[model samples]
Target: MYTIPKTSTTDMEVTSIRLEKELKDRLKKLANNKGYQALIRDILWTYVQQKSGDYQPQLSNSDIRASLPATAQQEERCVLTGKVIRPSEGMLLGLTNNGDMVPLSIDSLED
Candidate 1:
């Protein structure tokens, strides 16, 4: 295992991030010798990548919340079968000739 010398590195000012209790517990449990700071840095870097469109991180609660389109409370239905499907979840459900309604993720839906 590689070791980083504890010789005091140059200090950088850090702003406080308020992680939820559940997230904190999970991070503390998963952290290794590299520790919580490393994990936090990696997480922030991933978010940066996502913001810059350089990388596609797995969708998170923040991403979903931010991407949500304005909508109203009304039942939506399939034009063919008249089956109720919620638009908030942004599903792509379709029935084949065999009459199987296959549900697809929003990202997979092609324009």
Candidate 2:
């Protein structure tokens, strides 16, 4: 839920990348008042944090608002226990406080 901040945009170097016009338009629509560049930065940060070995999302069972049963369409990692959920495995999709649905091991909620 929280991450270590590397540095502010003030200390960052600028780099350019090209995107399809339609994609850029969609991003603009979604970004709204925050602006597309900031949105892009946020998306990159989320991806990097998820892939980082040291990243442990600051979440708890209490932070999960609900748990909905689901099946893994592809391999997924349980957010609570960091266990691999293979394709077709029965699992639970925990809806977090922030309204994100994350995979959970089948027995994560079991006593």
Best by lDDT, which number? 2
TM accuracy, model 2: 0.66
The Cα error of candidate 2 at residue 80, in Å, is: 2.1
| Model 2 Cα lDDT, one tens digit per residue, 32-104 | 9978987888777756766674445566788789998999999877777767789999999999998899988
Question: For every model in order, what is the number of clashing pairs?
Answer: 0, 0
What's the TM-score of every candidate structure?
Answer: 0.38, 0.66
Instruction: Tell me the whole-model lDDT of each prediction, alpha carbons only.
Output: 0.47, 0.80
- Candidate with top TM-score is 2
Pairs of residues clashing in candidate 2: none
